[model samples]
Each structure stands twice: as structure tokens, then as C-alpha cells.
Target: MMAGAQRSQTSFHFCHNPHAGSLLQGLQELRSDNLLTDVILCVSGKEIPCHRSVLAACSEYFRAMFCNGLRESKDYKVTIHEVSPDALQLIVDYAYTSEITITEDNAWQLLEGANFFQILPVRDACVTFVSNNFSAKDCLQMMQVGNMLSCPDLEKNASLCALKEFTTVSKTPEFLSLTKDQLITLISSDDLNASEKTVYRAVMTWINHDTRKRKKEMRELMELVRFPFMDKLYFLENVDNNNAVRKSCQDILTETRRYQLFPEEVESPCTRPRRTSGLREAVLVFGGLEKMEIGENPAVFSNSITCSPEPSTSSWTRVSRMKRKNDSRFAVAVLGTRNVIVSCGAKSRDVWLYHPELNSWHKLAQMKENRYHHKLAVVQGKVYAIGGRNLSSESSPWTSVEVYDRIQNKWTESVSLPKSRCGHAVAVVDGNIYVMGGLDTEYKDTSTVYRFSPGDSQWQSQTDMPLTTYAITASVLNGNIYVATLTNFLCYKPCENGGSWSVVVGVGTLCMYGMTVLWWESSHLWWL
Candidate 1:
């Protein structure tokens, strides 16, 4: 009885003090002295901490049991028994002092156990070690595991580190495994400010590849990842440093034309070859010209006509006109629904749909408001009436935005603009509504540009035009926003450092509105 009582007391003392002797020696002593605690071995082959009293209290023989096999086989080797002696000591101290001393060897394993058990000290200690000694490999592995474990802070750190490395050097085969979106996330990060120069140079060079607009798309993807404040300031500055960067990268790419930097361009899945019809016939629609001399109340003439991108050498023929005429600001947009052209603007509230085949006018309902000097854009079969003047006798700028749905045969009012603008040009580039070059309240021309996002229903200011001018024309061709003013044309793109615009070379224009665009493209061509 004396011996049994002494053994029970010794076992109790050992349970209260795990570090009273070597971990293995203490375990052997506890077995000899008496059973102090019961360690539950999960089916995953992981040992869990449990007091003997707690085990005794349970009806089941094991303190804990796995209902099913763990999903990951890697968890098998990461057991409490397999943990190094040093880590075991830390684990024991973590339960007692709540202070964990982590070492590199067992940091990950300890963290796994700590995370599984929801022990704060051990988990934190593991995090501290990993953060301080983070390597490329460690970051890569941790990024995958941490993200899965919902360890946000650790995942963020690992992602940032990997992205920083990707930016610093040309993305390797290993790094290229990251999605384009992920690469973009790193490029736009503020933490990598120190690595910006190297990262930007590498990223710019790598993405500027000539795999049929691949570089152009990468540039766009980078723009999308940009922080909102940075993009706003960048566009407001009116500089297109991308051209210079592109030029430099082009120079580098020119040397390495032999290398296949980008994956072969995949032909668009939705693209269908345009079927050629015999005779290449086209129909011409003419309307009233602007009544220049207001001294004479111009014959309430119906001049606004829907013009197609007709091939050169076509005749002047009248097809359709607006029901009400107010010096129709003529711009034609091809509707996707019926293969018809919609003569959109004139501030008359009425839209005339012209079928080139039928050569007839179909009058649609009036717009929400009268708009003039506005541009029309067709996006996903929806007609968007962008910036223009809300025509009234008082002559004020228009801020109201409207969209027409062909399927529903209705016009719905969208969010308005920040400013009432007129004579502005709008282009839908990658679902972003870019409003550029217009007159404000005072009718003073502007070079300011604003980008409207449908996702947020808000406007974000972007790069301004190089020269302020109203009645400018804007279009997106080959992923570049080309703006043509009365006298000049310029291409503006986002800068590499990312929050400003840089203008490319100025192009010469032969004439305004309907003038031949020949001078800008090549040498000279006559215009009527």
C-alpha cells in the first residue's frame, strides 16, 4: 500500500512538471510511477494532449478519435511523437508558461499542431520564426498551406514575398506558374517599393512580349490591379510613360525575337471568319448638315443621318432622318441585335434604327433626356449614351447617363457623371467607360478624362489629354486609346510606376470631324 501510494504521488508530480527530467525519461518515469495522462493517437497518427482525469471522465477508452482519414497524407508524418525534443519542450512550456521557443527544424510541424489545437502561443512562435527567416521555397510552400489554413497574415506575407521575387527578376518557369492576376497583385503592392525599379523593369520586359497583343493585354491586366488612388492620380497627371517603357522593352525584345517569351496566341474562341458576299455592296444614308448661319432660321431641315463605316467611293443617298431636328450631332453605331445601324445623337430624344438592307427608318422611343454632342457605344448588345450636352433652350451641360437595352426594348437611367459635360468622346475599353475631352459648364474646352466602372457605379478620374480641345474623337484600337483632336492625335497609356499618364507622339490631322484621316496615317490624301 505504501509503494502504490508513493507511485501515485510521483506520477502526479510528473504530470504537473513535464520538464522535471528529459522528455523520454519523464515519460518512462510516469509509466513506472503510475499513469498520469493519456495521449490520444488520432487516425492521422497525430498525438493530442489530454489529462488522465479527463480521459477517465469519458466513457470511450481514447480521449480523441478521428471519424475519417485526413485528406492529406502529409499530415501522417507530422505527429507530436515525431517532433524533435526541442520542439516537444516548447510544446510543453507552451501549455505551462504559455511561452513557446520555436526553432527552424520544428517550426512548421509545431505550427500545424498549434493551429490544429488552437494554441495561440505555439502558433505565434512558429509565425515569428517563419516571418524572420522566410526563404523563396518557404514562402512558396507557406503561401499554399497558409492560404488553405486561412492564415491570412502569413499567406499575405508569403504572397508578397513571392511576388516581390517575380517582379525583381524575369518570371521563371517556376514563377510563371502563378496566374496573371496574381502577378498583377504583386506588381501593384506597396510593400515592394524598394524593388520597384528591378521589378518594373523585369515585369515590363517580360510582359511587353510580341505574342500578338499579349503584351498589350498584360499592360491592361497591370492597370486593373492598380490601387484606385494611384490610378486616379496617374490619369490626372496626363503622362503616358508606358510608351517609353514599351519602346525600351521593344528594343530589348527586338534582340530576343528568336525566343518564345509568350505562349502562342490562342485564336479567340468566339471569333468567326467574316463571310464574303459577292459585289461587296453597301447602302449610303445622308442627313441634314449643321445650319452654320443661325442668322437665318434654317429650314427645319432633317439633316442628321446614320452613316456606316462605308468603303471609299460611295454615293450620297438619303435613308433615314430624326423625327425632330435640332442640328443633329450625327454619330452612327451598329447594333448587334438586327444587324442595323442606329443613328444615335441629336438631343431629339428619338433614336432612328436604319436597316441597310431594307433602306427604311424605324423610329424608337425617346431617350430619358435630350443629349447632343454625345458618343454612342455598343457593349454586349446594350447601347450606352455617354457624355454630351443635355439640350435645352438654356444651353447647359448634361450629367445624366442612360443605357438602351435591345432585348427589353427599353431605356434605363444609369448613374450620372461627376460633371455636366458636352462635346465629349466616349469609348468602352474593356468594360470601362472612358469619357474624354469635353466642354464643362462654362463651355470652356477640357482635357480631363473620367473612367466609369459599372461594377461600382462610380467615376474615377484618369489621364487627361495632352492638349485641351472639345469635339475630339476617341477610339480603342489594338488595346490602345487613340484620341484625335482637331489638329493633333495622341496615345495615352498608364505609366509603369502606375499612377500617371504619358503621351506618345503627336499625330497630324488633315481636318476636323469628317476629314480624311490620311495625314495622320501616312503622307497626304485629299478630303472633300
Candidate 2:
């Protein structure tokens, strides 16, 4: 008796359940033969025969209607609103077979029906299909559908696609069909990825598409552009000379003129540079020591500068040189105003601002302490100079930190680092400053990482890096910090598992000291 009871407890299990598919097939065949289906779905004057139990098992909509004591629970025929007949048929087939084909023509209709029927798998699949196949032609329509369906991921992807291809998308009739608020929202983004001239042309095109209806929206639309960043010739010929622009945007034009004439004095959105303007991503080589010959002889520190709009082609153009000669190892950062700020790295207290449009440099108030081999980072529009050594204190690095004051044109003392170090790398992510691997107070390479919030009085220590090396460089992309060390490339995720480090790639023979790494679009790193 005991052996029989034990044998009965040992039950067989089937992970694949070979009969499940056949069971569904049999149910589908029965419904096809009009044998056992108890419910009929009516849509657009057409009827779809389905089993109530099968429908209820797959869809919360049908389950609630049939099992929640609703009137439809007792009825054999139910009318489905909003969903078309073809869409209803597809949904019923999916409920029985657990699979359905999604084509370009039927994707939208299926998505709407699935959303209405609370069929999450089908809805998610439709969203994925639309997002993966998004193009400039259908991005606007997808964005509208996403918004109506309350799918944020789909909406965000579509918006990004439209922005990336704005030059081509703006010429489409769909762009003209956008409402005023929608147009404003699209044009106001800094990530539009189009030149100011192109944006201005697109705005003009939209207004001209319907002159009487959109003429009153001209000023509001034009205000979204960064006019000061436009080319002087384009502004004169296309904008200043346009009678319509003159009539609707006189005050904006005057402000733009002031911004052009006296840029340092003007402080407005018009003066702020767009990401697609002259301030677009480019490789800027600052003043550094360059060898005159190929041999390992003494090199001379020069104030010359160079830039490359596209680094992959290796095409470099000489830009305006720095005013101060023999300036090397300085910290360079782009400010919120889109101007490059260079702090002297040659044991001097001088700071300079470079204007890309004018191709000129202007002097700013100097720092109180001299710094070299330090790092500069911009956080929330303020510049912070991190640790480095000075000539007077050659034995020890400076622990003092300074924040640049643009208004006063001077540097003010801020919270200092816990330990003095030099040759460190600094990066900003989500408004917080991250200082990574550098030499510590012992003048030894350390992998310690420190984080500082502007509102905090002191810096907090996070997870250390994998490699311990100085003369490192770091940059932020997509909310993560990428560090380039002498021998390896590393990525630090601050929000993951209380700050974790991962090795992205090994530098191997490509390793070098005093290198700077910048992250741009196209997933390419510009190394200098």
C-alpha cells in the first residue's frame, strides 16, 4: 500500500505540452465548421464567430464583458465598436492561434484594436513593428498614433527619427499638417539636428503653405530659432530682406541684431547656440606641445589650434590660434553659451574664451590659483576646475576647487577635493560631476572615483575604476561616463548596482598618454 501511494505521488510532467497546439487547432477547426462557437463579434455590419471561453482567456475586455456579470455575459451576439471588421477578424484569429501577421497596411488598425481589447502582447508587437520601421515619411503619423495610444516609447522614437531627418521631413506634406502647438514643440527642441537656416526655411515653408491661416503664427514660430547663430549672409538675404518676416518679427529681428553686434552683452535664448549650429560636434585640438621633428627631441609648446568637422575623414582645418603663446596642458570645456573656455595650463592664472563664429578669442578674468594637469567640467551652466598641481607646489597637488563666475568674470573658491591629485579626468552626467582615476596625494596612480553635487558641501566616493592610471580622459554619452585610460577603455554606470565599472575595450598597442577622448553621435570616439 505504501509503495503504491509513493508511486502515485510521482507524476509525469510535459514542458512542451505536445497536445496544446493540436487542442487549439481542433478548437479553430470547430469554429470554422460552425460547430461549437457560442459568441459572434459584430463589427461594421460584419460578423466574426468565436468561442466565448477562448476569447475570455486571451482578452481582458472579453473576459470582463462575459464573466463580470455584464449584460453581454448572457448574450450570444455582441457589437464591438471602434474596431473594423478586418481588424476584429484578425484579433479573433490571434486569440485562437496565438499568432498573427502584421503588415504595414494592417499594423495601425491591429494596434488600435489590440489596445481597445486589452491584448497586451499584440499591442506591444504592433508598437515594436512601428518603431522599428519608422521613417521620415511615416514618423509624423507614428508620432500621432503613439500619442493617441499613450505609448511613450513609440512616440519618443518617432519624434527622434523626425528630428534626425528634419531636413527631409520638413518638406513632406505631413510636416505642414502639424498643428501650431505640435510645430512649436518640434522646432523648440535643441536636438532637431538641422541647421538654423534649414529650420528657418522649414518655418517659412509651413507658413507659406497656408498664408492666411498661418501668417499670425509667424512670430511665434520664428522665435523658436536661434537667429544669432545663423550665417550673416543668409540672415541678410533671406531673413532681414523678407517683408513677411519684417512685418511679423520686428522685435525679434532687433534683438537678433543686438545679439550679433554685441554678443557678450546679450543674454537670451536667441543668443544661445543650437546643437546643429556652428557649435555642432567637432574635434577641436587645443594648444599643446608639438614636436618640430620626428625624433624624441625637446618639443616646443605652441598656442596653435585645429579642428575637424568630420574626424573619420581626418580632414583638419586650422582655426584661430590662442592669444597666449606657450599655453599647454590647459583645461578646455564648452560652456552653456556654446563658447569654448580655456583655462591656462602653463602655471598661469589666465582664462580665455573662444568664439567659433568670429574665429577669435577674448580674455576673461583669471583664476586665483595656478593649475596644470587639471580637468574642467561644466555642470548646470557652471564650470568647475578640479585637482592639479601648481609650479609653486610642485611636490603636492592642489586640493582646492574653483567655480568660474561668468557674471563677475572671475573664479570663486568651491568645495575642495578630499585628496590632492593631478592628471585626473572629469565628466558631467545628469547634473553631477564625476572625477575619475588619477594620482593621489602620494603621487601614485589611483582608481578612486569621486562624485560631487552642486548642492552638497563635499564630494562622495563611489565605486573605483578597474584601472589605475593618470593622464586619463572621460566623456559622457547617453547618461553614462566613458573613461579612456592609458591601456584600456572603461565605462562606469553610476546608477547601476551602486556604481559599477566595466571594461569596454582593451587599448593594447594603441595606448598613449595625455590623450583626450570625446563622444559624439554615430557612436564614434574622437581621440586627440
Candidate 3:
């Protein structure tokens, strides 16, 4: 009876078999021989306790085995508190002795727990799970999240998925808001069908059309829409004379015809005259009295200077001290090739033409008479100096006018003013010079405005200005003449067929000087 009882206890202790018991006893005998072993296992939250027996049964494996499938791993500082009781027991048993037999079915659950715990090896296992299960539907939200987090790999994967379905995705308003250039790349590449490309362009045009958010941007969009048609016209005229080509060109012109004013109304309170050649950036204005002082220690003198844009003020930087000193008046205009011609008042007999690019001055042929406070303008590529005075005697102002032909580099006599006037203002609008309010025959202020056409050599009557303003400034903006009245400013919109002037919005009150009202194409201003 004692022998039988011992056998039963040994069988239960070894668990699997009597030979397994004998082998375990033999392994135990070798324990004192400094033996080493390792084991790894993965199990579900409920299977942890069962893993404890396996770990104890294979004690030799515990010597060097590393277990990563636990919800809490000893590698990082993070401790897992929400582990199941059974899983916790399994983890503890594995920690005490690294022996376990985790089955494949339970491997995924443990891998998920390991991922949550951020155990790198186990987290890697979960990524493998994803790679094995990747699908088109799974990529949408994943890519969005990846992009939001700046995850480069995930963004690429998501973009690939979106591109796969590009042909099928309808061009909704939401889709239109996507980056147009990116969509265009997809369209132009052979990756999409011809129909898809056509649809995309149509949708893009619809989305970008008729937008007036900025006047400049609107103009650009209109140009973009017209380019294809323009190309067709050019191709027809040069490459082919076929009836189809001619018909196509005619149709395009009809579709894209733009009715522009002969004198384009450049939007402004601009301080410079309209360019004869249509271009955007302003030609720099130089040569004027910028400063004046009244003491002898520094030698008091009046000098005019330039002020440019605020940052580095690149447009026009002012220079100090006039080359010659005198009581001065001036008329400034931009002529051919971006050169500015400045005819000074009676201050000097020398005609100073300023070259902005060179930052220097040059003397031109002298005017026929010494005229100051006269109105000067560029008309049809010619400079006309009108109605100024000679201080040679106190006798007073002159109404004589002279036209300087820039192309010929010679002065031609033109029809003189209706009367002798000084301190008057002149601005060229739509090829006609409008000479307005000045000190008239009696040296008192006058409100009369006269229009001169060099083409006809004739003077016509016009409505008087609202006020008598001398030493005022005038500019043209958006095709309308903006007159800087002495204390205020007014707008003049030329009639389409030529009759009268109409008022535009009144600008704010004046800040006066011997100001030249220039249409600073960039800012559109009337300046002091």
C-alpha cells in the first residue's frame, strides 16, 4: 500500500506521464550544475493562471527567457493597472520564472495588450496584423489621421488609396476646395482617362470662375480662361488656313472679346499720369524740391526730395540738396523707355531730364522761354509746356505754350492758352490736356477749366471746377480724373463720347503742399 501511494503522488506531481516525472527528476538533479534555459509564451487575460503551471514545469527556461506578451512589461516606466486578475497572475508567474507555453489562438490578444502597453516587440506584432488585414475602406480615416499627425508613411499610403479612386470621385464643392495643382497633376498624367481630365478642367473652371475677391486675382482668372481660346486663334492664323480653323478663331474672339476704354480708367487716387504703354510698376519720379530751411549756419536753402515704399523704400528714395538754388516750380512726366523728363520752373534755364536707373541727372535742350509755375504734360509722345511766368520782370505770367517732340528731340510751337494764367493745374486724360483753375489775368483765383487737343490744335469750353483752387494737384484713376481741390479733392469721369465730367467718390480732406498728384500705379494716390 505505501508503494502504490507514492506512485500516485509522483504521477500527480509530474502531471503528464511517469517517464516525464523521471525526466523532470533528472533535470532537477542537474539544477545544482549551474544550468541555464529560457521560454516565451503569449496568452489571453483569462489564461494567465494556467501559464503559471507551464512556467513552473519548465523552470530551466526561466534562466534567460524574456516575456513581452504581458499587459505590463518591465522594460519601460509605464505600469499597466487595468490588467485582468488571471493575466496579472500569468505575468507574475512568468516574471518569477520565464517559462510559458502561449498558443497561437491566444497570441493576438496578448499582442494587443502588449501594443497598448507600448512594448515595442509586441507593438511590432500588432503592426504586422494591420499589414495582413489592409483594405481600401480601412485607409480613408487612417490617412486623414496620419496627415493630421504629420505621419509621413501613413500620408503616402492614404494618398495612394485616394488616387486609386480618383476616376470615380465626383467633383463636389468639397472636392473643388482641394488643392487645384495637385488635382491637375493627377489629371494631366495618363493615370486618368480623357473623360476624367475633361471633367476635372470643367469643374475647376466652374470653381474658379467669376471670383472678384481681389480685382487683380479676378483679372488673372479671366486671362486664364481666355488663354486656351487665344491659343486656338493664334494657331489658326499662323498654322492653318482651313475653314474650321478660321471659324474656331472667330468663335473664340466672340467669346473672349473684352471692351476696354480707349483711356483705361486706372483705379486710383494715383499721383502719376497713365502709362502710354500699358504696364504695372511705376517709373520712378526724381528731381524736385524736397527740403527748405532758413538759417545761415548751415546755409538755409529749399530742397525737394523723394520718399519711397516703407521697407527699404525701394521705389524712389529722396536725394538731398538741389544742384542749383532758386525760387522753383516744376512739371514732371515719364517719357519713352521709363525715363522721366523734369522741366523745372523759372528756377533754371536748363531742362533737367532725370534717369532713375542711373540715379543721375542730365541737361536737355533749353526751352524757348524761362517759364515757371507752368502746366507740362506728355501728349502722344510729345512734351507741352503751357502757361507759366517769367520773374525776369514783375510784369507777370505767360500764356504762351510750346510742345516738345520727344521722338524728334525738337520743340514745335502749338496753340497758346486762351488767357495768361499761373498756379493753374494741368493733367492729360484720354489724350486731351485739361487745364483747370489758376491765378487768372487779374492775379486773382479763377474756376474755369479748359480742354486742349493737340490733334485739333483747338481749345474747348468745359464746366467750371466746383471751387477756385490754385496750387492744387490732379491725378487720373480708373479712367477718371481726380482733382485735388485746395482743401478737398474731386473726381472726373470722362464721357464715353466726350461731353462733360461726372463726380466720383470724394477722398478725405486735403493735406496740401506744392503737391504733384501722381497716380502711383501701385498705391493710386494724391500726395503732398
Q: Which candidate do you rate higher for TM-score, 1 or 2? A: 2
Candidate-wise lDDT, in order: 0.54, 0.83, 0.52
Candidates arranged by lDDT, highest first: 2, 1, 3
Instruction: Select the stronger candidate by TM-score from 2 and 3.
Output: 2
Which ten contiguous residues of candidate 3 have the minimum total lDDT? 259-268
TM-score against native, each model: 0.42, 0.56, 0.45
Backbone clashes for every candidate come to: 13, 0, 27
Q: Write the per-residue lDDT of candidate 2 for residues 321-428, one digit (tens) a residue.
A: 887777666888877555898888776888888988789788988888888888898765577988898865546777889998776777899999988889888987
- Ordered from best to worst TM-score, the candidate numbers read 2, 3, 1
Model 1 lDDT at residue 268: 20
For residue 35, model 2's alpha carbon misses the true position, in angstroms, by 3.8
Cα RMSD (Å) between model 2 and the true structure?
A: 10.3
Error at 262, model 1, angstroms: 34
Error of 2 at 444 (Å): 25
